[model samples]
Target: MKPLLLEIGTEELPVGALPGLAQALFDGVVDGLVKRGVAIERDDAKPLYSPRRLAVLLPGVAAEQPEQRSEVLGPYVNIALDAEGQPTRALQGFAAKAGVDWTRLERTTDNKGERFVHRAVTPGAATAALLPEVLAEAIAGMPIPKPMRWGTRDSGFARPVHWLVLLHGEDVVEAALFGVRSDRMSRGHRFMHEGPVWIAAPGDYVDALRAAHVLVDPDERRERIVREVREAARAVGGVARVDDGNLEQVNCLVEWPDAVTCSFDEEFLAVPAEALVATMETNQKFFPVLDEGGRLTPHFIGVANIESKDPAEIRKGYERVIRPRFADARFFFEEDLKQGLASMNEGLRTVTYQAKLGSVADKVARVAALAESIAPKVGVEPALARRAAELSKADLQSRLVNEFPELQGIAGRHYAAAAGEPAEIAAAIDEAWMPRFAADAIAPSPLGRTLTIAERLDTLAGGFRAGLKPTGNKDPFALRRNALALARTLVEAGIDLDLDAALEAAGADVAEVREFILDRLRHYYAEQGVPPQQFEAVAATHPQSPADFDRRLKAIAEFALLPEAEALAAANKRIRNILRKAEGAIPQRVDAALFAEDAERELAEAVDAAIADTDTALAQRDYVAVLGRLARLRPQVDAFFDQVMVNADDPAIRGNRLALLQRLADRLGSVAAIEHLSS
Candidate 1:
């Protein structure tokens, strides 16, 4: 075995796409080696990358592929040899293709008859001889979103390629990519080192680059960035908010990273922290510093690509670059405060929400109506929820939000508070957009939860009405995300509002929208560790309320773990199938005098008792207790199916037996369609 290294040097690649591009490159090479029959230790392989380069290093790779062999089956003996026991035309042709005499070919026996076989073997070629093709194939498949060509090259890549490196076990493996030939030479940091660096072996790549002031490994670079930012924040007596996103982008933008503390006038702190943080992180990629209680501080950290001798100068440059953005934000804040949040709603009447859904004002009105209708049911003042909904989308017209689009809801919260609205209403205005992403938290306040459900209901209604439903990956309106959020808010908040009624009031097709929203739960519960069978079992009951669906799903999940669960589930399935195939109308009530078997009478008695025992629990949606009560009937159910002939010769007796099974099936499906769990 031998170690291998491959590097592709280029002009600065896209910072946001650097990590994915590097991963794709690493996977492509590994796949290529395996497809070519080259053995490798995947655990020992690493991908190293920076803005200027993408590299892959393998600590152990096969020196050569294993020996190649093949076998071909020829015509059967009866066809190969005629009645005279002589070679036929088919045998001669087979031997010619095998490059051997017909008599030398081996014979193998099968069920049909004897057949001739041709076996061939050849020695594997040297790994070095195949490296060029393997490396070229790997490079040709890189996922570059927008490939660019440099100077007169016919082909394009993510960036203009400047150099290539391919080394194996201290030897240069010859390969070429994008008008450049592979060699041991690699360029160092653009400013820190002026000359090319020499790589003697694949094992020495990291150390050699570190000496050249280039931290080639992305993980090491990211860790150093986090530590430096934290220490810098501590020096300023605050904690830096080093989010994964900003850290990753910063790591890609630098080869050697160093954090420097910078600050703005405390006056800029009066602006919304989210806006200021957006300006720093989103616009400039700086890490914001926060006080112990998580309030934003004036001090922030910027990671520089170089360790300058005059660190103060770098700090000054960083301060100067951020000053204008902060000042603009401060001005926008003051202007918006002067204008007040109420005035922001006037322009919304003219702004279109969607072509088919009317103006933004229309959406606000729909959301307001829905919120007011649902508030009292979920324990909130209708007027307060309606007021929050009215101001919910007003921030879309604010100057601060215009500059920072992600702060739509957050900007409204600040404006509402500044306008003398109640604290809960202000918080609700922002919380209305809770769980803005997959990993975000849902609304924690009653009024906020009301507004969230209302807004998502309105959005989903308009989206489905406009025919913008997601098909495969083409969700332009993000309706799938909105549906999942809607479901999550209802279930997580413990709100049991009727989903079908709400959708009907919002002018949506209740059945279609309900099914659409429930479908997203398939993925949601998969992440929650709930099996699909359990989820589908509850879904089959068509619980119109999301909270009820959640209740039944939990009950089914618990039921699946019981000792009698499997047999009960199987019995329910059998009963369902039996009832489904009845020749005549199955009677709803079973006559006591018609029971011909003791097993039938026992099952009937058990079914009635179980129903009476679980009646109150069923009405209250305490599905766990209801299912537990139903599980006890498993023994009677098993005995009845074993002893009774459901299709009896007497028509009256047959109808009664089917009726008994039908009664059991209905009760079994009361909590969930347990039959889904059978298989």
Candidate 2:
């Protein structure tokens, strides 16, 4: 057995390319080694890479592949025999091609009856001899997301291949790939170090590269980036609030990292802090600055490839980058405010919500009408709700939104105040899009909450009417997110809203959205370990309202608690079984005059009372109370089944019993289609 190492060195590759290429190289090598009959022990393997090199380290790979014996089917017995009962020319020819003598052939049965088969044993080849070919194919087969072709060869990669290293336990192994020859060399940090260093074996892969100024482990590189960046920011008495996503992108962009702090003009701070940070982190991948009071400062941090020979020169270069970005942001903010809330409202006329449904102006009108209609139901003044809805989407057309795009409603709030709008109106303008994600807080002001619901309802209804319902995991329109936000808003506001009524007022456009939300409830119930059928049953009856369906589902689940709930479920199953057997068979009458047993009369009376009580409770919306009362009839019903002959010779008696069973099923179904429950 011997340890092995293979490194593919190239010029600076994209930071994004390293992760996937490293994984592909590892998979390709392991698959190749296994195919060559090399046993790879767990303790003998490692795969790591930086931007400049991809390498695999394996210990104790077997010296040769295991030998195998296989049976090779040949000509049938009929074809192999001659007229004299001796082997024919065809049989001799088959044996010759198989490299076996006729006497060594074994007779066996084939699909057409008897046939001749030959046995051959293949001995494994030397591991060293197989390595070069396997390594060549695997490297050539590496799945680059997109590849290129360079030099005279047809092969293309993330970057042009410069060198290859293949080692077998400190001994050089000859392997060529994509027109490049194997060697023991690897390069280090693109700027700080250049040329190559010899790798002794798989064991020296990481430390050897480190000594040559490369940080090969991605995690170690990430930690170093974070630590040095924060330390550099702190030295300037400012905190570096680096967004997690930006930090990751920055980490991959460097090999040997240097954290650098820089400043910009303080006057640029007049632009909203959000736009400033977005420009820095998004466009430049720089960390933002925060003061002791938690306000954003006019400073930022960036990770540089090499520490500057002159610190002032680097700072000036960074300043040059942020100044233009800030200038554009400031211009957009001031221009958006000058348009005023009234002018922004006019721009909404040209914005289309959906192709088939009409423009955003049409949607705003529908939402405004719906909001006024729903406001009184939720205890908000109708005038206030209408006013809020009118202003909600006006900010969407603002110049600030035109520039940042992400700051739609946010910029609206600032502009509204600058234009001398009322405090409540300005707050509503901002709050309209209060929740943009799962963890975001819902809007709380009275008008703001009203406007939020109105907008979501309008979007949902319009999409539903347009036939773009969510399917499977494909919610391209984010309909589920809107539904979740609506549910959370209702619960948090402690507002008792009739979801069906609110949707109806939102307009006929979103009926499909309502159905989509109902479909989503099955997932919510399933995650709680409650059967989806239980939720479906409730939903089938109250599909328009999530709160109502949830209420009914909870009641049915609680009713399933009584000792006889399972028994009733079982009894209902039996009744269904009987009904299925008696398909198309009807009992025409249940003659009370033909009643012959006390159990029969008792069961009929119990069912009648349970039905009456269930009806009363249901009329009052007391679902749990109805379920509690229905459980009392289960025992009596079970007793009747035990004592009475349901298919009695007396026709009148049989009909009455059939009718009673139907009554029991009806009451149980009112709560839930109990027959649908799985045991």
Candidate 3:
């Protein structure tokens, strides 16, 4: 047994696909080896990658596959035998194939009586002899988005393979791909190290590359980049803003990294910090430096692949290249400020939001109306919410937004504030797009929450009406995300709303939209660790409000932990099934005078007393207390079921019994359908 190392060198891989390409190669090779009975030494092994290579190093792998064994079946008894019960030509042929005499051949019983069989065992092949095929199979399974064919080779990959390294311990495992044969040599940093570095063994690969100025381990290189950027930012008296996404992209763009702090013209600082930060982070892959207040400063840090002797020149190059974009952003900001949001609103009339949903202007009008209608429910003024919604999409027409599509709401917020709009109004314009992605915070302000809900309401209504509902993985309208955001804002932000009423006011099909929105809670509650049956119990009651659903679900979860919960849940299930199978109409009220069993009379008396207590809790929406009170009746319920025959032969008595169960079912289900909690 020996450690194994494999590296595929290529031209720079695409930033988006580099990690995935490495992962796929690692999974394919490891799975291929394991499935063939090759024992890997470690279970926590992982793949390593950089801009120009994908590599995997296993601590140890088996020397060879397990012994190979097989069985082959031949003609059945009738076919292998003749009427004389002697060895026939077919039996001789089968024995000849097995290289044995007909009398020495083995027989096995099958569905068709007896059959001739051949069993064989062969020695396993050496791991070295199997490496080529395993490597080839792994290469074939790469998830390359756009494969390229180079030179005269008909085969294609993400890039032309420059070298292939396959080393088992100190020996070079024989392998070849894309016309390149495997060897112990690996190329180092394209600039810092001019020649190939010899890899003596799998254990020495990473250290050897590091000595040649190439950090082969991506995590090590990423942490180094972060440290260098932070140190550079400190020298400039600011802190670097290194978000995960930009950090990852920059990591993919370098083999060796050095952070250089650069500065732009002070005049450009007049533009919104978001616009400038977007220019630096999104476009240039530079980390913007921020002050203590979390506002962008004039300095930004750019990570370069080469640690140049003349880093000042690199800094100048970074600064000079960033000026034109900053100037363009400043020009757009000043121009949009002059036009103001009201005039920007006019251009929205000419732009279409969706093909089926008419123009952006139409969407704004619908949203504005929705915002106004929902404003009162959230304790916000209708006029203020209307004003905020009216201009929420105006920034979509701005040159700043056109240049940075991600700055849609952000630019509007800045524009509205500059226009001397109220503070709440300005924040609302931006807040409407809150939680721009999954795992983001919801709208912070009441007016913002109102606007967000209203906006999403109209989009969902318009989207479902236009037949834009998502099927499979196709959600071009992002309706699923919007629905989740809407439900999350209501439940998380404590915004109480009548979802059906909101859907109706938005001109939506109430039943359809409500179900679609509520379904998102399945995932929402699942993430919160609520059991599926508990969520179902609350959902069964068809709560009208998201906050109410959350409330009831919480109560159900808490109620489930009680000692009597199981028995009560089982009783509810039994009652529900009985009521479902009843033959005729059940009485609305239980007639105590018709009760034949003492247990039934006792349960009816308990229900009349508990009814008033549950009513008070139900009115107060204290679902936990209500379920607790219902749980106390578990003993009487068990006794009644155990001692009484609900399906009595007497007609009046049967009617009374069904009515009695129905009454219990209604009260028990007032908060949630506890019957679903039954196993």
Candidate 4:
């Protein structure tokens, strides 16, 4: 095995594009080597990057491709020879194409009968010999959204390539990549190092760059930035609010990181902290400082690319660049306050939510009505939920949200509180958009949860009505995400409202929207390790409420583990098939007197007793207990199928037997259609 390294040094890449570019290059190189019949050790390939370069290191790469064998099939043995069994032109022609003599070929038999075949073994090429094409292909396959050319060359890349380092152990791979010749030398930090750093081997790459003030490993740079920024915030008696996204972007923006403590005017702290933090983190890559109480402070930390000789001058530059952004945020906040949240919401009348779906004001009205109807079901005050729904979209008209769109819900919460609305109502304004993405938490307050459900229902109904349903990654209306969020909120939040009722309140087709929500539930449960058939078993019943659906699924999952579950499910499936084939509609009530066999008599008693025992459990929504009670009848169910035949000569007996089987199937399916669980 030999150690391998490939580096593409270029002009500074976009901070947002660096991570993706590095990952693409690494995957492409490993895939290239594997496709070429090269062996690589598990976990041996890894991506490394700084602002100016993307590199991949393979610690255990094979020195050459594995030797491969080729087989060429010729005409059948009978057709390849004359009646005397001598070589013919057909065999000769095959041998000539295979570069072998006719006598040297072997005869093999397969489904097609006997045939003459030629096999050849070729020596593998050295890894060095294949590096050129492999490197070129990997580079060409990079996901550069906007590639550009340099000088007079038509070739383009994410950025202009200045250096290429391709090393195999201690030797150069001898290749050209991105218009640069492969070599052992790599560029270092732009300001800290004056010349190229020589890599003696693939293993020496990281250490060589580190010594020249370039931390090529992105993880190392991120850790250093986080540590330095925290320490800098500590010096000013505050803690650094190091968001993961801001940290990642800052890590990609610098090769050598130096954290500098800076301060803005204390008056700027009067503005909403979100607006200030947004300006600092989004416009300028700076970590905001918060006091021990978790409130934004005047102090912030900025990571510089170079370790300046005079730290104060660098701090002044950081402070100077952020002042205007903060000032604008303060102005926007003060101006928005003058208009008040209520007056600003009136502007939604003119703003279009969707052309066919009417304006944002129309959506707000629909959501308010739905929230009002849903509040009583969820045990929240109807007036509070409706009020929250009304003001939810007011933030979209705020100047602060206009400048920073991420602050839409957050800004509304602030404005509502300032306008003297109830605190819960204020919180609901923001929490209405809770679970903005997957993996986020749902609304914690009952009022918030109600408003959230109402808002999503209206959007889903409007979108589906407008014919904007999702198809193949093109969910212009985000219906799939909306459905999941709606389902999750309903089930996980312990909200007991019927989903169909809520959909009807929003003017949506109850049956159509129910299936849409359940489809999303299928995907949602799949991630939780529930098999598709398990989901289908519960979904087959078509529960009208997500909470009801969730209960049935949980009960079915537990019941599936019981030893008797399989027999019961299979019996239920057989019962359903038998009923489908009956000549007429099966009677709801079975006549016990018409039973002609002892097995039929026993099954009727068992079904009656099971229903009597589980009636209370089913009514109480204790599906687990209900399914368990029904599972106890599995022995009787299996016996009935074994000893009794439903089609009797007497019509009265046949109809009674069919009614008995119908009862059994209904009792078993009350919780879920167990037949779908049968293998």
Index of the highest-TM-score prediction = 1
Q: For model 2, where is the 10-residue window of minimal lDDT?
A: 582-591
TM-score per candidate, in order? 0.96, 0.77, 0.95, 0.95
Q: What is the per-residue lDDT of model 4 for residues 1-679, given as tens digits with 9 covering 90 to 100?
A: 8889999999999889899989998988899889999988747456899989999998888999988888888999888999999978988888898888899998899998999988889988898998888878888888888998888888899999999999988999898865688899999999989999999999999999999999998888988999999999999999999988899999999999999999999999889898899988988989999999999999999999999999999999999999999889889999999999988999999999999989999999999999998998888989888889999999899999999998878999999999999999999998898888898999999998998899999999998889898889799888988999999999997677777777887888878888899889899999999988789998888786888899999999999999999988888889899989999878878988898889999989999999999999999899999999899998788788889988998888999999999888888999999999888
Candidate 3, superposed: residue stretches over 4 Å from native: 73-80, 87-105, 108-116
> At residue 241, what lDDT does model 3 achieve?
96
The whole-model lDDT of each prediction reads 0.91, 0.77, 0.91, 0.90
Worst lDDT window (10 residues) for model 4?
38-47
The collision pairs in model 2 are 44-59, 148-156, 461-509, 461-510
What ranges in model 4 sit over 4 Å off?
82-92
User: On residues 497-594, what C-alpha lDDT tens digit does candidate 1 reach at each position?
Assistant: 89999999898998899889988888899999999889989989988689889999999989999999999999999888888889979887999999
Q: Is candidate 2 or candidate 4 better by lDDT?
A: 4
lDDT of 3 by residue, 59-89 (tens): 9998888899878887787888899877788
Clashing pairs in 4: none
TM-score of structure candidate 1: 0.96
